[model samples]
Target: MVTSYVDEATGLLREDGKGSAQFEEVVLHPRVTVADASMAEAARAAHATAHDWCFIARSVNFPVRHEATVAVG
Candidate 1:
């Protein structure tokens, strides 16, 4: 989701404004699966750790955060 500020006179988004027409907050919902139910906790931890190592997330300037969930079946 994003929040943008528009120029009412020009009827255009203010690119230079504080909250310009840009992707401000990006939420990532990553779903992980584990073979064993007992390993669910480990899978969650790994997912969390993986974010720091992710190239795409690291390359982005804006906030690329997540609300992750784990499942086992």
Candidate 2:
């Protein structure tokens, strides 16, 4: 899932240094994910309605930079 999202973002956003002097991450979320045992629907719904209001997102024109991976079972 993380790979898919990264690939999709690569298409939507310039890969790293395609623009500007250079690109560097201002923040990194190390442990965020969706899980089967959690309230996925509620989380999705609330996030959809509230995601844009995030201070970091509103502050930057570039996409948030982070890497997320699930442990192989």
Candidate 3:
């Protein structure tokens, strides 16, 4: 899940007429799974790569941060 906090004073306006929007903060939660313990480390590393490759994330100038969990099921 992803979440963002918008400044209420702006009334959810997209911009200040300056093309700059108000996004107080953004948080991302991503979950990854691996087949076994041997692949756990690699799966964790892949998460970073996946984030880097996200088009929306890469296109945004604002910082996009995440809290991720990797599990073997």
Candidate 4:
């Protein structure tokens, strides 16, 4: 996720704009599994919750991306 932001900042990800940054959603690692669907859903919920706590959300110069890691047991 961080990679995506950095990439955009560095012009790795570009659209019509020459160098533009945008907000993006970062998905959890596919390794995350679910015995029940709720497990993965729970992890996603927690991740989304934690993202609100990050300082990067305040950054305006660069696009912000969050990394989600779902644990599999």
- Which candidate has the top score in lDDT? 1
Which segments of candidate 1 are over 4 A away from where they belong?
1-20
Tell me the deviation in Å of residue 33 in model 3: 2.4
Model 2, residue 5: distance off in Å is 18
Per-candidate TM equals 0.64, 0.34, 0.58, 0.36
Report backbone clashes per prediction.
Answer: 0, 0, 0, 0
User: Which digits, one per residue and each the tens of the lDDT, describe model 3 over residues 1-73?
Assistant: 1122222111222567877867544557666666677777776677688778878667766666666676776
Q: Give the per-residue lDDT of model 4 (tens digit) for 1-73.
A: 1112111122233365767655343332323444554476776676577657656655545444545555444
- For model 4, the stretches where C-alpha displacement exceeds 4 angstroms are 1-38, 67-71
lDDT score at residue 39, model 3, on the 0-100 scale: 72
Looking at model 1, the pairs that clash are none
lDDT of 1 by residue, 1-73 (tens): 1122121111222265765575555666666665667877877687688778979778866667757777775
How much does each candidate deviate from the true structure in C-alpha RMSD?
A: 11.9, 8.5, 8.5, 8.2
Worst 10 residues of 1 by lDDT: 1-10
Clashes of 1: 0
Ranking by lDDT: 1, 3, 4, 2
Please tell me which model should have the higher TM-score, number 3 or number 4: 3
Residue-wise C-alpha lDDT for candidate 2, range 1-73, written one tens digit per residue: 2211222232132355656453343344333244442444544454444445668666876656433333221
